[model samples]
Structures are given as C-alpha cells and as structure tokens.
Target: MQTITWQQFEQTDIRVGTIIEVTDFPEARKPAYKLMIDLGPLGIRKSSAQITSLYTKEELVGKQVLCVTNLGNKQIGKYISEVLVTGFEDGHQNIVLAQPASPVPNGSKLM
Candidate 1:
C-alpha cells in the first residue's frame, strides 16, 4: 500500500453528517440512493451512495455518517453529488457505512 504523510492525511476533509433525507435514484446505472445530509456549519449537502444492498430509505434517516466533504462534486446521470459518503465493503461486497461509534456534533472533523 502507498504511504501518506501526516500532512496529507490532515488535508483530507472527513467530517460527520446526519442523513436527513434519502430517495430512490432510478437514473443511476447501479442501484443507489440520493441522500441529503446535514453537515451543520457546512450546511446541507447532497450525495449518491450505493448502499442499497444493506440499507433502506426508512432506516437511513437520522443516521450519522462520515463524509469526505472536500472531494468536490461528482456527476452521476442528472445528479450532482456534493460530498462523498464513505463506507466499507462487507464479505458479500455490500456497502456498510462508516460512522461514529457514538453521536457527535454535526460537521465535526475526523481528527
């Protein structure tokens, strides 16, 4: 694996955000959800997450998730994802969202 400096790690703007809304994204090539996240001081941002294999829209609301907020926008079909909702792949290659072990203030930087 490639190694990175502390500065490089620090430069990554990873933060906590609450999932306020989730909706179906039929236009996406892969099954996914369009999410609206509340990042507190960072304001609300939109993202597209391919976590449908393990998550449902009803279960996603109010969930606090880690987001890479500075990656810039990603264009997927007609959607413009404003942030990157991070996660890990399970044994079945399904996504399991990255999250805090406990609740934290929104927009809190991962240090």
Candidate 2:
C-alpha cells in the first residue's frame, strides 16, 4: 500500500452530510441518483451516487453520510457534483455508504 503523510491525509476534507433530496438521473450512463445534501455550516451541496442497487431514495433521505468535501466539482453530463459521497464497494461491486455508527452533526470533520 502507498503511505501518505499525516499532512497529506489531513488535506483531504472528509465531512458528514445529510441527504436532503433524491432524484433519478436518467442521463447518467450508469444507474444513479442525484442527491442534495445538507452539510450544516457548509450549506447544501449536490452529488451523484451510484448506490441504487443497495439503497432507495426513501432510505437515503435524512441519512447522515460521509463525504469528501474538497475534491472540487465533477461534471456528470449537466449535473455538477459539489462533493464526493463516500462509500465502499461490496463483493458484488455495489457501493455501501460510509456512515457514522450513530448520527453526528452535519459537516463534522472526520478525525
């Protein structure tokens, strides 16, 4: 594995955000959802998550999730993703969201 210095790791701003809205993204080549997330003091942000196989819109709403907030925007067709919703690929390659064991304040930085 490649080792990164503590400074390098700290430079990545991973924070918590709660999903506030969910919409279908038919324009994406892969099945995905357009999400509006509330990052507390950071305000609302948008993201595109391909976790449709394991999650539903109803389940995602109000769910606090980990996000990489400083990667900059990614353009997917016409949608601009402001943050990267973090997750891990399952054995089937389906994404399982990275989240806290219990609810934490939105925009809480990962330590």
Candidate 3:
C-alpha cells in the first residue's frame, strides 16, 4: 500500500451525512438510487449510490452515512451527484455503506 503524510490524509473531506431522500435512478447504466443527503451545516447534497442490491429505499432514509464531499460533482446522465457516498463491497459484491458506530452530528469530519 502507498503511504501518505497526515496532511495528505487530512485533505480528504470525509464527513457524516444522513440519507434524507431516495429515488430510483433508471437513467443510470447500473441499478442505483439518487439520494439526497443532509450533511447538517454542509446542507443537503445529491448522490448516486449503487446499493440497491442490499438496501431498500425505506431502510436508507434517515440512515447516517459517510461521504466524500470534496470529489466535486459527477454527472450521471441528467443527474448531478454532489457527493460520493462511501461504502465497502461485501463478499457478494454488494455495497455495505460506511457509517458511524452510533449517531453522531451530521457533517462531522472523519478523524
């Protein structure tokens, strides 16, 4: 693995956010959902997450998740994703969201 200095790691803006809304994203090449995440002081941001394999929309709402907020916007067809929702791939290749161990304030930086 490549090693990096603390300043390099600190430059990555990963923060906690809550999934406030979710909707089907048929326009995406892969099966995914368009999410509205509430990042507290950062305000709401949009994301496209390919987590339909494991999570239902109802289960995602109000769920706190980790997000990479400095990635800039990615255009998925007509949709503009404002943040990169963080997750890890399961053994089955499904994504399991990266989240806090318990409830923490939204927009809290990962230290």
Candidate 4:
C-alpha cells in the first residue's frame, strides 16, 4: 500500500454527520443504500453506501456517521452522491460504518 504524509491525510475533510434519510438504490449494480445526511454547516449531503448486509434502512436513520466531505460529487446512475460515507470491510466483506464513539456536533472536523 502507498503511504501518505500526515499533512496529506489531514487534507481529507473527515467530519461527522447524521443520517436523515435512507432509501434503496436498485439502480446500483451492487446492493447499496441512498443516504441523505445532515452535516450542520455543510448542509445536507447525499451518499451511496454498500452496507445493506450489516445495516437496515430503518436502523440507519438518526445514526451519527463519519463522512469524507471534500471528495467532490460522484454520479451513480441517476443518483448524485455528494459525500463519502466512510467505513471498513468486515471479515465477511460487509461494510462496517466508521462512526464517532460518542455523539458529536454534526460537521465537526476530525482532529
């Protein structure tokens, strides 16, 4: 794997956001969800996460998750993903969302 300097890593705008909406994305080749997150000062941003194996739509609402905000927008079929929902892969290859240990203000930057 390639290594990056700490300064370069800091350039990544990882922040906290609350999931306000979740919907199924059938258009995606892989199973995923369409999410609308409230990023406080950043406003609402949309994301597409392939976390269906470990998460349900009903359970995701109101959950605080880590987001990479400055990745720019990505087009997934007709859906426009505005932010990246950060996560790691589980042993079974399911996505495990990266989240704060405690509740933090939405849009709070990672330090």
Candidate 5:
C-alpha cells in the first residue's frame, strides 16, 4: 500500500451529510441510486451511489452518511456526481454504509 502523510490525508474533505433525495439511475452501468445530500454549509451535493443492492430508497431518506466532498465532480453518462458517499463491502459483497456512531451536526468534518 502506498503511504500518505497525515497532511496529505487531511487535504481530503470528509464530512457528514444527510441524504435528502434518492432516485433510480437507470443510466449507470451498475445498479445505483442518484442521491441529493444536504451538506449544511456546503449545500446539497449530488452523488451516484452504488448501494442499490443493499439499500432501498425509502431507507436512505434522512440518513446521515459520510462523504468525501472534495473529490470534484465526475460525469457518469448523463449524470454528474458531486460527492462520494462512503461505505464498505459486507461479507456478502453488499455495501454497508459508513456513518457516525452518533449524530453530529450535518457537514461536520471528520477529524
């Protein structure tokens, strides 16, 4: 693994945000959802998250999630992804979302 200094790692803006909207992304090569997250001071940012195999739209609403907000935008077909919703793979290969142990202020930075 490539090692990165703490200063380098600190450059990434990892923050908490609440998922405010979720929609089906039929254009994505993989099964995915288009999300609109409320990042407080950062405003709402859109993301194309591949968590469809594990999460339902109904279950994602108002869910606070960790996001890498400074990755810049990426275009997937016709969709523009603004942030990366953080998660990890489960034993079954399903994505399990990464979230705070308890609720903190929305847009709080991960220190």
Candidate 6:
C-alpha cells in the first residue's frame, strides 16, 4: 500500500461532531439520510449519510461521530452536504460509523 507522511495525515481535518438531526432523503438515488451535525466551534453542518441499513434516526440523534470536516461541499440532488461523516465498511459492505470510544466535545480533532 502507498504510505503517507505524518504531515499529510495531520493535514486531514477529521473532527468529532454530534448528530443533532436526521431526515429521510428520498430524492437521493440510494437510501440515505440528511443529517445536521453540531460541530461546536465549527458550527452545525449538514451532510448526507448512507447508513440507513444499520442506523435509525432515533438512534443517531445525539450520537458523536467522526467527520472529515474539510472535504468541501458535495451536491446531492437538492442537498448540499457540507462535511463528510466517516465510517468503515462492515462484512456486508454496509457502513459502520467511526466514533470515539467515549464522549468527547464536539469539533474535537482526531489526534
């Protein structure tokens, strides 16, 4: 695998945010959710996450998740996703969200 320098890794702005809101996105080609995340100092940002296979809106609310905050906006249908909610692929290729083991303040950078 190709390797990256420490500086390059540090350049990635991965931060923690709390899921404050979730709504169904029927306009999306695939099943997805429109999320409003509270990133503390970074402010609340919107995103589209395809995690419906394993997560429900009720369970996601107030859940702290890791997000790539600097990845610029992504346009999906009428939605403009402002951040990237990060996750790993499960055995079935379903996304499993990445998060801190314990609670941390929102907008906390992954160190």
Note the Cα lDDT for every prediction shown: 0.97, 0.96, 0.97, 0.96, 0.95, 0.96
Worst 10 residues of 2 by lDDT: 84-93
- Candidate 6: residue 12 lDDT (0-100): 96
lDDT per residue (tens digit) for residues 1-111 in model 3:
999999999899999999999999999998999999999999999999999999999999999999999989999999999999999999898999999999999999999
C-alpha TM-scores of all predictions: 0.98, 0.98, 0.97, 0.96, 0.97, 0.97
Per-residue lDDT of 108 in model 4: 99
lDDT of 5 by residue, 4-72 (tens): 999999999999999999999999999999999999999999998889988999999989999999999
Regions more than 4 Å wrong, model 1: none
- Which stretches of candidate 3 lie above 4 Å from their native place? none
After superposition of all CA atoms, the RMSD between model 3 and the true structure is 0.7
Position 83, candidate 2: lDDT? 99
Report model 1's TM-score to 2 decimal places. Answer: 0.98
Per-residue CA lDDT of model 4 for 1-111, tens digit only, reads: 999999999899999999999999999999999999999999999999999999999999999999999999999999999999999988899999999999999999999
User: Which residue pairs does candidate 1 place in steric collision?
Assistant: none
- Report how far residue 36 has shifted in candidate 1, in Å: 0.1
For candidate 6, which ten residues in a row score worst on lDDT? 69-78
Candidate 6 structure quality by residue, lDDT tens digits, 2-110: 9999999998999999999999999999899999999999999999999999999999999999999988999999899999999999999799999999999999999
Clashing pairs in 6: none
Residues 35-86 of candidate 1 have per-residue lDDT tens digits of 9999999999999999999999999999999999999998999899999999
Question: What tens digits encode model 2's per-residue C-alpha lDDT throughout 1-111?
Answer: 999999999999999999999999999999999999999999999999999999999999999999999999999999999999999999998999999999999999999
